[model samples]
Target: MKKQDTLSPYIHFDRKDWAELRSSTPLTIDEDDIKELKGLNDELNIEEIVDIYLPISRLLHLHASATRELYESRNVFLQTNVKKVPYIIGIAGSVAVGKSTMARVLKALISKWPNHPKVDLLTTDGFLYPNEVLKERGLMEKKGFPESYDIAELLHILSDLKSGKGRVEAPVYSHITYNIVPSRTQVINRPDILIVEGINVLQPPKNGGGKEIDQISVSDFFDFSIYVDADEKTIFQWYIERFKLLRGTAFRNPQSYFKKYAHISDEEAFQVAESIWNRINKVNLRENILPTRHRADLILRKGEHHFVESIKMRKI
Candidate 1:
């Protein structure tokens, strides 16, 4: 264990120490279940889940339990029935850093708890502006950048969810088509738990007209948030690997927007992938995503092999 420095709000733990905190948390997921939860080219297994994620699930369960108690207490004091709002959890990270896999695993594990049996997973990819809009705005090449998202609509949905809306709908995005699917929507019912995952979920509100309004950012609605961290060099490697894997799989589909890459040679594909990463994703990570990491309630730091090495959790 590393010694904590004074004035730091985070308590740090190495992987071995963190795994011991699992205590009596049971592993509810099996091998077959993990296969369905893992992202493309991601390395995940039962051991990692038991050591890394089981403890997280337990922590979330505790948080959710406490929140419900608090809400009930408030209602009793007011002597009125108040609607129970969903507990929102945000997962943010650089592209190809496995935020999607983490979100999926948490959704499955946390939903199994008796207290919050209803869980829903939502990704911000669906909230990105349609390709036509991006092209019209001349932001087609900056797809993953914060400016490429429909920020106002995303805020409206979160606000509605937090206000205890019975039903809310979000647009559906398709990687094969590389655009928002026409007329398709994901219906979010009133769930006990909601996981919102994306690269820019933690971004601070931008100042409009040289003045800051008292408006709430998307992250302000979150009861808990996590940031997945990895070195820039290693993440670049994972991005390239995922691109190659997709070329052999999803990109080969005739309807896929990236189908053109499937016909290219390995060398050509690598060059293209590298170019895209250097020109777009890398810049977005450094300038936007990485800067917001410190705002997370929990930070899962990964090592070279895509395994989590340590965790830094906010103590206050």
Candidate 2:
């Protein structure tokens, strides 16, 4: 199937003609402009980003500003209505497609904006079901799948934030141990901007009657959303590289759950990685993740080398 015809929220980029499609909004930021958040690497430095991400940062700022005005107008129209607060942005992508890095970068950039100086970042990993629950359900292999997360908790938290609730507490996940530790909730107090980045944040609410209770989806709380997109082949390569890097770093820690994978041979590691990808991540991507691509406000399409080569914006 052609890239654009896919129903996913992301638009895939092949080596065609995209140079002319680069944004012409004249929104650019150099390294000196945002020295707060550490760049992922020298390759992701501001000079390499100004032409690509700067305009995106500006677009997000504009969207946030407009959303604030919209709420104010509605609040005025309904005299009894308290102001709906906090512009929420959801960032979704595969595990190693650099969504976390993008979210952190945006958090830093957006917080610097005068309109919303109190931006916060949250990850859905924190909401995953406890290890005991997963084991009881025989779903250890489906860890990153939507079923692995505590959907009820996630939904409730998002609902509270959308209703302008103050001082929301979210649990923290340890990447080193790959588990939800205890009592480590992060408090987000009256944030102007909330960026929720997760693998399945865009999944639709389950339908049907009877035992299933209908509820609002997490995507319903988003004012704007971004999907970091790239080809599956490229993402696989990136994931393998990331896994290899983590082995020497986080995976070697005594408290890490993936310690078993730390000492595997390169060939064995590749097999394990491919096994996890093919059976788990790829299934989630094809079934749940990719189908939600069209839901994104902006799709940042990356090239073979992992740099965002083009962007597709949903028509207003």
Candidate 3:
């Protein structure tokens, strides 16, 4: 493993050094709150929250404060009292690598600051194309890939949010149904802070028709972004474990799209999980997700048991 100082464009801190930075930041979240925030099969604990996530929340608060000051300054220069837009944060990582858990934890912690900014959490899963559309396009097997998302709609939603459009509506997705709920929507008012979490949140714009045209991606609106990272072997193991766990829980539900897996034996389930990882999730991670890690403002590198081993923050 490379030493902390050896990383370029980022200042790295090991677990101890990072924990020491959590000065005076009260751990506002309790055990019950943590239970509600953690994802299924995730190894998050209160100790990890106090040591790893508290300092991150403080840093995010500082960044949000700085952004507000800049916005005020710009408004003054323009001599117009424009409404301040929300500060957007993006979180990206591989499947089963715990990005959703980090996003929920950060949202909880950040909302407890003295300013008490109204924070909203959004996941890009809702922006994925409906199952019918994917099946019609013969892309059902590539569900989590970048192309499977309604990128234009996602861009429009983020663009509207950043432009101070109040009461914007986003589609709602159901894990059990494995599709968008047609009549359901999540209304996001003008929040002071918005956290968008997804696998492809850090992806850059792709070229179009061999023409060089300026394009804005969903990430372009992000004020700060984080990438949750871990070794591929660790992620693979976690993904398989989560698959098995879900089979015994969510997949057993009659409404679950994955209900077919519920009847499989543990050995059969393992084989199916391994096949999906090798065929879909692993390929998506290598070709789409991992390449964008360097674009993040901060990277949380996790070790065994999903504990944050080190943190890397990009230097200003």
Candidate of highest TM-score: 1
Question: What's the TM-score of every candidate structure?
Answer: 0.96, 0.87, 0.96
lDDT of 2 at 270: 86
Task: List lDDT for all candidates, in order.
Answer: 0.91, 0.76, 0.91
Instruction: Name the regions of candidate 3 deviating beyond 4 angstroms.
Output: 1-7, 209-214
Give the per-residue lDDT digits (tens) of candidate 3, residues 5-79.
Answer: 554888888888888888999999999998899999898888999889988998999999999999899889999
Error of model 1, residue 253, in angstroms: 0.8
Q: Which candidate, 2 or 3, has the higher lDDT?
A: 3
Worst 10 residues of 3 by lDDT: 207-216
Candidate 3 matches the true fold with a TM-score of 0.96
Lowest lDDT 10-residue stretch of candidate 2: 13-22
